[model samples]
Target chain A: GESVGLHLPTLSVQEGDNSIINCAYSNSASDYFIWYKQESGKGPQFIIDIRSNMDKRQGQRVTVLLNKTVKHLSLQIAATQPGDSAVYFCAENRNNDMRFGAGTRLTVKP
Target chain B: GAGVSQTPSNKVTEKGKYVELRCDPISGHTALYWYRQSLGQGPEFLIYFQGTGAADDSGLPNDRFFAVRPEGSVSTLKIQRTERGDSAVYLCASSLNPGGHETQYFGPGTRLLVL
Candidate 1:
């Protein structure tokens, strides 16, 4: 009985604004999590990942926050741009099986 | 360096036919995984290989779906009696694992359509 899902299915943001996508996972034993961005007809590109040992990890223009107590994960994109428009997914890797949340579509408007 | 790659970016076939999807993981990546993504849904795990052996095949939907990694570099997922429901984007991912600390890189994926 394990599932990973996002809180929102779609999000709209203006260029230069910030965007936040949230995910909730049912497995408390999941120790590793990742964020992926998939553009149309492209693969899910690796954005950032956070281990259970760390609460936060940052990358170029992106940040991933993990809250183990609540089994919640969130990805924050700074200065969101048109290029950032895509579907974002959060995944939990446990027991060598990676489980992905449905996804959140982010549209960047001019 | 080249990223993980899948062959035949797209494939269309008739129902009840058979198809093969191939994945070439990044060089030196010890772990490879396969997933299926439907329209508007996240990719679901199908299988994983550790080196030349299949460490996990539990996620495969049924016996008709099979995957293998020989020589531990390339993998092929074979489907028998392919059905319309099997039409989806098949994804492959590779990760350089240093124990639990790892990040998975995905390939473009093969978009399969059953007619």
Candidate 2:
């Protein structure tokens, strides 16, 4: 079926280490992609976004990489901290409709 | 300015009952959307409101699920004859418009538990 999925369901990283979460999208028409972090009992908070025209976008401590040729997206968090522990989701947009992936649970162990 | 807000952070109802969840968008936001999040799953789009009208309701599960945005600022999601399967976290988000550049600010969400 057509959907977005992550390569890993959960990822654990040591404090101060770098963490990378991968996502695969099936829709070739997706023009934009965004990464969001959702703490327990809270809604998803926007992290960073990238468009198909660009291959990489960097935020404060996060970076989003898009490979339109492979239909893959990646989110990299540098110097992961305990406060960053949450479920991270990758969303893809085609036209104005957005679709989300199952999400990757990120746990930063201190 | 404050972000989006939702009423009744938690609600519990029995099966076959009716329930309504409300969402108040940020000031000036013209696009509102409703999504449902199941355990360990991503938020699934339920409906979208552009201004005061429903622009796309293709994500609605069935006739029992309905949503309306009367004045373009606040919206409500109504579930008729709710079933246990309807239990999930209902989330509301608002954006400047239904475009890619506008960030979608989300509310805390209303956790609905159907017994």
Off by over 4 Å in 1: A1-8
lDDT of each: 0.90, 0.90
Highest DockQ against the true fold, candidate? 1
Clashing pairs in 2: none
Instruction: Kindly report the interface RMSD of candidate 2, rounded to 1 decimal.
Output: 3.3
**How much is A10 displaced in model 1, in angstroms?**
0.5
- For all the models shown, what interface RMSD does each have? 3.5, 3.3
Q: What are the runs in model 2 whose C-alpha is more than 4 Å off? A: A1-8
How close to the true structure is residue A53 of candidate 1, measured as C-alpha lDDT?
95
Question: Per-residue lDDT of A28-107 in model 1, one digit per residue for the tens?
Answer: 98999999999999999988999999999999999999999999999999999999999999999786778888888899
Using all chains and alpha carbons, the TM-scores for the candidates as numbered come to 0.94, 0.95
| Weakest ten-residue segment in model 2 chain B by summed lDDT | B97-106
